[model samples]
Target: MSSSYAGQQIAFLTQHGKEQVIAPILEPALGCVIKHVTGFDTDQLGTFTRDIRRPGSQLDAARRKARIGMELSGLSLGMASEGSFDLDPFAGMFPWNIELLVLIDDRLGIEVVGMAQGPGHSSHVQASDWPAVESFAAGVGFPDHHLVLRPQDQDDTRVHKGVSDWTGLKASFEQCLAQSGNRQVFVETDLRAFANPSRMQHIEQAAQDLLKRLQSCCPECASPGYWVSERQPGLPCSVCGRPTSGYLTEVWKCGRCLHTSVQTRTDCAFAEPKHCASCNP
Candidate 1:
C-alpha cells in the first residue's frame, strides 16, 4: 500500500455536519486533513425537502460539490458526499438510502468514487389532529431522527424543518394546520445527515469504502484506486453444469493508466440451481 494522499489537505464542502462522520475515519487512516469548507449554502444545489430540485444525477452532484470545494480552498485534491432515498432495489418494500463520496484529484488527473446503500428513514403523513400527528411521529423515530412538516400535502411549500422534541413538534403541527387550506398538516422525517441517524450511518460507511478504494494500488501503473470495473457472469450451475447468472470473474482496472486485469472467483466455483435458468427457470 502506498500513501499517495499522505500529508495532503482534501477540501470538503458541506453544511449539514457531514465532517463529524467523514473526518474521523479518513483523516488518521489516510494521513490527510479534511478541510471543511464553509460560506456556501449547499441547499441551493438541492434539498431532500423538495423545495429546491437537485440538478443532475447523484454522482454528478457529488462531483460538482467536490470541484466547488477545491476551487474555494485552492487545493488540488477535493472530496464531497451526496445521499439519495428510494425504495429498496431488491423488493421495493422498504425505504433505501444510497450515499456517494466523490474524490477529485487534479494533481493525479483522476476521479474515484466510493458508494454504499442500506435501509433509510423517509416517511410522510397527512394529519388533521394532534393524535394523528403523535402516531406518525412515534412511528418515524422522532426526537432523534428529526422531522419536517408542511401544510396540506407533501408538495406544500410551507415547510418547517428539524422538529426534534415533542413540544416543538406539537407547536409546528398546529402552525401547519392553521396554514393549511385543506386543514391537513403534512409531516415527514428530516432527511438531513445531521438530523437523521440512519442517513448518517450510511454516510459513515461510504467514507470507509472510500478509504479502502484509496488504499488499493494499481499493479501496472502503481496508481491508487485500482478496483473492480465490471463483473462477468458465467458460473456453471451446480446441478445442470451450465452457465448461470452468477458472476465468475471481476475485471479490475486502473483509473490513471487504464491498465486492466481479470481475476477468477475462487470463493465459489459453481452457482446454485436456483440461479440457473436452464436448471430452475
Candidate 2:
C-alpha cells in the first residue's frame, strides 16, 4: 500500500542540521522529498541557551515552525521538530529530554505528532575556578556535546556558546571568569540539535516514530496516521478478578477522516496483582 505522501514535497524548517537525521529516515520510507527551508532564524521562537524565551507550549512552537516552513516553500505539507529539557518525570533526579516532530497536512486538514523522551544532557554548574569547570565538562560529555558559558550565572547575557574543543572551552571559561562580578562562571551543556548528540539521537527516534504513524493506513478511510489515540482501563486483576489500573482497549483514530478502531489485547487478559488498585490497597 503506497502512501498519499509519496512523491509529495514536505517542507522542513530547521537550522540545526535536523534535516540530516530526519530526512534520511523519512524520505526513503515515505518516498517524499524533505525540502529543507532555512531562510528564517528559528531561535526567534526559542533557544536552548535561554537567550530568547519560548512564547508558547512545545506543541504550539512545533506547529508554528511547520506553518512557517509550509508558507516559505508554498507546499501543502510540512513538518517541524522541537525539543524540551527538564528533570526526568519518574524521579526528578536526572536531566531528561523530550523531542516532538509535528507534521501538518494542509490539503488533508490534519496534524500528526511523533514524540520520544529519554535521559538528556541539559545541566548547569557554577564554578569559580578552572579545575571545577574541567570536572564539570568531563562529567557532562563536553566537546562531543558542546558547552555554553556565561559570567556569574545562567541569566547573564554576556555568553560564549558552542564551545566544542577543550581549549576553546577553557578560554571561554577564563574569559567569563575574568568578566565575572563574583569570580564565577556559569557553564551548561549546549542543547542545540547539532551540538548535543544525545538529544539528536532522540530526534531521530521521533522521526522513526513519525514514519510508523505515517505508514499506518486507516482501515476505514485508508489514510495515514492511524494510530492509538486513547486507552481504556479495565483489565481485571489476575488474583482478585477485579478491574485494575491497566489498559484493556486501545482506541485507534485517524487524523484525516476521523476514523476509529478499538483493539483489545489478546495476549493478556488479566493485569498483575501489583497493578490492581483494590488488591494492592
Candidate 3:
C-alpha cells in the first residue's frame, strides 16, 4: 500500500525551518527526498501582515508556493505549508491555529492538501514600554518560544522579529517605541514554524495527514490522494432513534479522479438527542 510518489523528488519551498518537521514524515512515508529551494522569495507571493496580500484563498497561495518550488528546483513535484491564526472555530473563547500543507505533482497532474488545527495555540499582546514588554513576554511563553516586535498602530519598516531572549526583545521594543510616533510596541508570538513549537506540532500532524492520503489509492481509478473528503450526517438519535445532525458516515474521494466511497464513523454508531433535529424539535 505504498504511495505513487515512493521514489520521487519533492521540492519544498521555505525559508523557515519547515524541513525539521516535514522531511522526516514525508521521507519515511513516500520514500522521497525533500529538497529545499534556497533562493525563491516565498514572501513575495503573500504574507500574514498583508504587505503583499495573498493572491487568492489559502489553497491558492499554497498551490502557487508549491508551483514556485517546483519551477525553481526543476522538479515536477513540490510541497509547501501555510498557517493561519485566529479565534478558535469550535471554542470561540480562545485563539487557535490552522496549518495547511500542500503537495503538487505536475507529472501526475495531481495535488494533495492536508490540514491541521490547534486550539488555544497562539496569542498576541501589545506593550508600550520596556516594563510592559517584560510583562507581556511572560504571558505569551516568550524566551522559551520567540516573539515578533512591530508597531502597534501600523506596520513598521524596521521590525525586529524572531526575538527569543530578554535583551534582544527589550532592545527591539525600546527602539521601535522611540520611533513608532505612537508610543507603543506591538509584541506577538512569532507564528513562523521555526519560532513556535505549537505551530510546528500542528505542521507535523499535517505532514502525516498528507502522507496518509497519498498512500491511499482510489479503488476504481487507482489514483493517489484517495481519502476522506466529506461526511454525511444522519446517525439516529441515541435516545429517540431519529436522525440527527451528527456525522454518521465518512466520505472518501480521489484528487485525480472522481471516485468516492462512504463508511460509518469509527467512534459512534448513534448520535445524541441534543443534536437531533427531529428529537430536539
Candidate 4:
C-alpha cells in the first residue's frame, strides 16, 4: 500500500455515487484519500441518453472532468471516470462497455489513464403496451438494473430516467406512451454507475488497472504511470516466417522524460497461418 501519493488527497469528480466503486480500490492500493467533489454537474459534459453530446473523445472528457474537480476542490491531483457502450467490435452481437479512469497530476504535468473493456448490459426497446414493456424489462435484468423511458419519437425531449422498481417503470411507460403521438415508449437500460451493477463492476476493474499503472514506475526517470504507449504489429507467420498483423512489440514509455523501451509479447511468439496474407491470399 506504500506509494508516492501516500497520504495525499485526490479530488474525484462524480455526483452519481461512483466514489463507492472507485474510492475503495484506489485508497488502499495507492494510500491516497479520495475526496468526492459535488455541486459540479458532470452531465454538462455529456449524458448516457444522448441529451448533451460529449464535446470530445472519452479521454478528453475524463481529463476535463478531473480538471474541474481539481479546480473546485483546490487540489493538485484529481481523478475522473468516463464510460462508453457500443457493439462489441470482435463479437459483433454483444454489447461492449469501455470504462476509462483518469488521474491528472497538475503539479507533475502528467496524465495517466486506466482502461477496461468487456461485455456489458446496454440495450433498448420500444413498446406500446404494458406486456411488451414488462417483457423488455425482464430481458435487461430489471430492478437490479434501472431503465429510462421516453417517447418513441426522438424529438420528444421529455425523459424519465433511473426507473428501478416495477411500479415506477410502469408509471413512466404509461406516461411516455400517453405523451407520444405514436403511442410507443422508448425504453433503455440506465447506464449510470449507481443504478447499473454491470457498469459499476467495469469501473472497479478500471480502478484496479489504474492502481497497477501507478505502481509501475519508469526505469529511466522513476516517474509514476510508465505504461505501454504504442504497439508494433508484425508477428511472424508460423509456417512461412513472414510478418502478420499481430502485435510483436509493446513500447513502454515514461510520461515525464519520454524515454521508451520495446518489450516482446510474452504470451505469443508466432502468428497463425490463417492470419498471414501470403498464406491466406
List model 4 lDDT by residue over 107-222, tens digit each: 67788899998888899887889998899899888999999899975446898988999999988988898889888888989998998889989999999899889898988767
lDDT of 3 by residue, 120-233 (tens): 346666667687778877977788678888875546666677798988987788778887867877777777778888888999999988888888888888888888889888
Error of 3 at 10 (Å): 0.8
Clashes of each: 0, 0, 0, 0
Minimum summed lDDT over a 10-residue window in model 2 is located at 1-10
* Residue-level error in angstroms, candidate 4, position 58: 1.1
Q: Using lDDT as the measure, name the better of candidate 1 and candidate 4.
A: 1
TM-score for each of the candidates: 0.98, 0.98, 0.92, 0.94
Q: Could you give me the TM-score of model 3 versus the true structure?
A: 0.92
Better of 2 and 4 by TM-score: 2
Report every candidate's CA lDDT: 0.93, 0.93, 0.82, 0.90
lDDT string, candidate 2, 1-281, tens digits: 44788899999999999999999999888899999999999999999887899998999999999999999999999999999998999999999999999999988887889999999998899999899999999999987999999999989999898899999988899899899999989999999999999999999999999888888888888878889999999999999999887989999998888988899978799999999888788
lDDT, model 3, position 7: 81
User: What C-alpha lDDT does candidate 3 achieve relative to the native structure?
Assistant: 0.82
- RMSD of each predicted structure: 0.9, 0.9, 2.0, 1.6
State in Å the error of residue 92, model 2.
1.0
